[model samples]
Target: MNENEAGERQIDIMVCGAGYVGLATAVAIKQARPSLDVVLADAAPDGVWKKDGRASAIAAAACAMLQRLGVWDELEEGAQPITEMIVTDSRASDPIRPVYLTFSGEVEPGQPFAHMLMNRDLNGALRRRCDELGIEIHQGTPIAGLDRSGACAVATAKDNRRFSARLVIAADGARSRLRDWAGIRTVSWQYGQSGIVCTVAHERPHNGRAEEHFLPAGPFATLPLPGNRSSIVWTERTADAERLVNSDPFLFETELETRFGRHLGAITVESKPRAWPLGLTLARAFVTHRLALAGDAAHGIHPIAGQGLNMGFKDVAALAEVIVEADRLGLDFGQEDVLEDYQRWRRFDTVRMGATTDILNRLFSNDIAPIRLIRDIGLGIVDRMPGLKRDFIAQAAGKGGPMPRLLRGEAI
Candidate 1:
């Protein structure tokens, strides 16, 4: 550890952003090598992230990683497993929406392929683990910029506090200041669509099923939560999204029920509706010198595939393995060659997932007659092939191909 002229603190590793990815990276590294110094810094004040009402689908591979990190058990009580997935294509007002493809959401006999996890619960559990692991956490300390000229990367907080570390992980989200400081370019574009997020309570139970109804505007996904509640990710044009989000409660609920079938019965909003503009953001490179990008800072894809966080978790796993093994072999963990290994390990998979989501969003978020006919036929064909469906379920679960040891629930 080193100190500046002002005597600010320095550490071996600094993780910028206490969100799931940042926390996971810190905890995974600390657990694998307990003696290494790790610090987590976030832009938000303490307890501010609890206000995030959104939830994400945790893939089976991510569940395994969390379990290995000693956080999943704390989240199990609030986590809702998705037992099945159904996809359909039709207009929002269509009386009959035909089911296209169906997937049984199970990786094994008793293990679910994924779970709908409230963001607060996930972050809370991770914070507790960080506390137990003795990983230093600095709330309200956003990385305003980064300097990588010396052996250690220096991070300057918005408050002007300086933290120098052998390596810096930028989990600072989609618009990353550290990424820009590192001179890493990105490939990005807006979809002109926004996702409306909210939680809803209904009279009938959802039976652990998830549905994706492809409307002309975009896909409307209803993911089952515990009890009679479900989380909705409703996509629409930006203007329509704003109108629905700001609509009166009665008007909003009426519109929601139109797309959400009557099977749930008497649905009411359990949380305030919020809209997020949709887009695709992929960093041109994952690493530069001693700095590395993870999670949203590295890639942000459409929510249509629900793989955004999973991809981040994959980064956490791969980066942790690379660093831990390199240290075990007495190599410079922050050197360009070592960091390049991580870049090569994750860049290809990230690009592939981003492309897949972009294509799916374009294909489903349209109403061209011939295009619809062809897509429906493709969906039907896939639905008929049980073997193909199994492969897709595994793919979505993040269980296919070569994975980092942590994702396989093994220690680094």
Candidate 2:
């Protein structure tokens, strides 16, 4: 650590952001090698992340990654497991898959394909764990700018105070000010649609099944929540979404019921509706000199695949492992070579997942007839072919792809 960034406090690493991605990165870094001094900063007061209506479906791989970082135990109770995944084309007359693809075993034996977790609950749990881990979390401090010099990176807060370090991790968010400060350009496009998310309480249990119902306007995904409540991701044209969200609760529930069907019984809105614009954004570069990017800071994708956070978790695991390994070899963890190792491992995969989600969202979340027929037939074909089903199961399990040990459920 440098003595001063022009006469200010110096730490080994100064993290910018305490969102899930930032916190995960901080915990992974600290857990990988506790000897390294690290600090996390965010403008949010005391790591508080307001609940915005929806929770993510954390892939088993992501759970393993958190486990490797020593944080999964804190998340277990709040997570709802997914035992089965049912995909349907609401346009088709016969929409149900002939056989439900069971990835329960493939996703991680005895665990569900993914665990649904409330955002604020998980964030609080992470904050508690960070506290236990001795991480210096500087809440209410936002980075105003940064300066990178020989063998060190320096960050300045809004008050003009600064800190120097051997490394800097920019996990701020999609609209990252840090990335901009680093002069790293990003490529992104508006999705022209918005995803309306909310929790619904119904008489029937969801039976641990996650359903993705493809509608004419978009895909209405009902992911299971604990007990009789289910989470809804209703995507539609931006105009339509705005109208529905502004509509009264009764009208909203009625619209939902008209689309949600009878499988889940009488549904009641449990929370206010929230809308998130769907889009894709990828950083032109994952690293610039001593600074590294992870999570939404590096890439943002459509949520149709439910892999947004999973992708970020992969980034956390990969970068943490690389830096930790370099430290074990008595090398500077923030050197260009080390940063490149992190980039090389993650860049291509990020691009592929980004493109895949974009295409999937465009294809299924529409009323295009030809594409609809192909997608429906493809689902049926995949259903009939057990070998293909196994392949997909393996893929969704987060296996047969490049992965970090942390994502494999092993400590670094």
Q: After TM-score superposition, what is the CA distance of residue 309 in candidate 1 from its true location, in Å?
A: 0.8
In candidate 1, what are the lDDT values of residues 1-412, reduced to their tens digit?
A: 4677756567889999889999999999999999899999874687788999889999999999999999998899999999999999999888898999999989999899999999999998998899999998988767777889987888887888888889999998999988888899999999999999999999998899999999999999999999999999999999999999998999999999999989878898999999999999999999988989999999999999889999999999999999999999999899989999999999999999999999999999999999999999999999999999989999999998899998999889
Per-model TM-score on C-alpha atoms = 0.98, 0.94
RMSD of each: 1.2, 2.4
Compute the lDDT for candidate 1.
Answer: 0.92
Instruction: After the best TM-score superposition of candidate 2, give how far the Cα of residue 35 lies from its true spot, in angstroms.
Output: 1.2
**Number of the predicted model whose TM-score against the real structure is largest:** 1
In candidate 1, stretches whose alpha carbon ends up further than 4 angstroms from where it belongs are 1-8
Candidate 1 displacement at residue 42 in angstroms: 2.3
Computed on alpha carbons, the lDDT of every model, listed in order, comes to 0.92, 0.82
lDDT of 2 by residue, 212-285 (tens): 77777778888889999989999988988999999998898888887777777899999999887888999999
